[model samples]
Target: MKEAEGEVPLSGGRITPDVVRVGNTVRRPVTAASEFVTELLGHLERQGFTGAPRHLGLDDSGRDIFSYLPGRVTPRFQTWSHDQVLAAGVLLRSFHEATRGSHLAEGHPVVCHNDPGPNNVVFRDDRPTALIDFDMAAPGHPLEDLGYMAWTWCASSKPQAPPARAQAAQVRILADAYGLNASDRAALIDAMLDRQARNADWWRQHLHAPDPRVASNDQILSRIAWSLREHDHTAAHRSVFEAALR
Candidate 1:
């Protein structure tokens, strides 16, 4: 089997996936569902969605290869300005829009970047340029994807909460950028809460043993709970989240 030249370990993400950089490509373990991911990426490429990496064919080691996007993933726990938050929303909406009417969305909806948080986003010139890590991508509701972004980007899970006014304003900005409808605005809070709760449950199930991965999962679970609580607080204050959007 041919080996990847000058392979260097890539940081972030759990250890099991074992992603590595080789030249201008990233190689990672292939799973049973990898072919599905490849097909999805091909569809995205054909549709001219530049927000995701182009999937290359498998390597000699049987790892899936993808064109390495030339940008950094936004660091965890980092706060974004109102503009940056708005940009994130726009980028996410673009992805959703691109997937609409594509083959991936014909029968069911397109595969969503189930985790589109800052950690999975690539930023260039301080703006989110693309999304990476399609490991969790699967057919799902667009709101489910947006809900994950709302919880993560809004800092609802952070230890130091932003002022209520600022938080509300940013939330409004994001919703406006995405052009969410009345129904989407009405469902946003519940969807966000549901996403976080589901994440906590997944972490709890997967992070049973002790390791760095376990610690990371614990932190994620804590944040998920925190975000859920914060969303509930917002709901208590406002009659409807749509008021913020309007």
Candidate 2:
């Protein structure tokens, strides 16, 4: 049992739970669901997946403690190089494979990171190496996870997003890296569209709330709208997207 050496505020999480680093551990306010997260992390560890933080139980303050993984987390909206995108795709596939046979992925549930965006990825040597923040983990279609990855990595919703052709090419790269089958390729765009719609609905529901979690709802709604429009534009040229992947 490693004792706390010191503590410092950890930033960037949207919910912004009381999170801090104590020596080699990260402590965050625990919820009723914390036990599930701890179990998930334990499953990942037993399966030999090294891409997630090791859950270290609770601290004296009753906050959930997780081993601190060392690496840079790419800031939201920051552009990534092609190689970085490829590495992210590979890492996500690895996570899916690791969780496939676990209780999380059995018929019991299809636990997904739910939010595997750049901000949640830890980069080492400029490559994505680990993922953190599994608060949104839940049962879902595996394609949903890939859709979230595509949305973030391809800059699908940004005003400065790449051209339609370029976006298609990047999507193809991601699909290829993840080893998606032809059937999966055909449904990729639709999956991404569904993810965008779901996110928009969540933000809309919270737009008028005064809670700290909803504080950024307006900005989030704007991004959702932008992303939906971009995705719609991409869908209009579905032939190009499908062709690139094929």
Candidate 3:
């Protein structure tokens, strides 16, 4: 493996990036989740999804060196964009299509990369490029991914407390770009809100990390949940969610 960038201290787990160079090609993330990641990589490869990084075998340091894909990494902190939203919609559709019918082992359900938020997305030419981070990416549901992504991007960090009407127009454009039909359009909105509510409670119970990043995520998640519950999500996002269906 190549040089170690030490551990990227995040909330869920420390992503220790170890760069490796095989011939002219360079890759990173060796042995971080060694066996699990190695196996996951194989599965993604077999499924014909080449967008994700390849999981290389263990290195001298016993770390797994994953392939390093090239693209612009979207920031976690940013306002929604029409193009970005469209790109996100398309990328998610692709990811979902790629993961169809892939079942995990008895004990190990195929965990999708749960967080494909802006930070998790890699962009090239103002479009989504690839996915990163898989800490809590386990035994996921495709619709759940849709909900999670919509909550973050469409609702602007919260489903109940989405952006104002003008901005929300752009948000609705995201789902439209993904081709949500009439029934799906209505259902997906509520599904996303429900997922946000559920995720907040889940994270509150599970996230007890010492890292500041984790702490911040917990705080934001708490706020998002609180805002949604305080206003009653159905009432709050009904218009915004419905506008897109129009």
TM-score, per-candidate, Cα-based: 0.85, 0.89, 0.70
lDDT of 3 by residue, 31-85 (tens): 3355565666678788777667776665665555556666766545366677788
Top TM-score model:
2
- Looking at candidate 2, the ten consecutive residues that score lowest on lDDT are 1-10
lDDT of 2 by residue, 104-181 (tens): 765633578888989888889989999999888876667898887877787464567677678788888888888988
Which stretches of model 1 miss by more than 4 angstroms? 1-5, 157-159, 207-242
User: In angstroms, how far off is 136's CA in candidate 3?
Assistant: 2.6
- Name every residue pair that clashes in candidate 3: 2-19, 2-20, 30-63, 30-64, 30-65, 31-63, 31-64, 111-138, 111-139
* Stronger candidate by TM-score (1 vs 2): 2
Across 1-246, the per-residue lDDT of candidate 1 in tens digits comes to 233569877765552357888989999889766877898888889878898899999998888999998877755746688888888999888888777766776565656888888888888888988888877777777789877787678735344777556666777778888888888887877777788678767666655565535356557667557656755665564543445656
After superposing candidate 2, which stretches have Cα over 4 Å from the reference? 1-5, 106-110, 157-159, 210-212
Error of 1 at 10 (Å): 1.5
Candidate maximizing lDDT: 2
**Comparison by TM-score, 2 against 3, better one:** 2
lDDT of each: 0.75, 0.79, 0.60
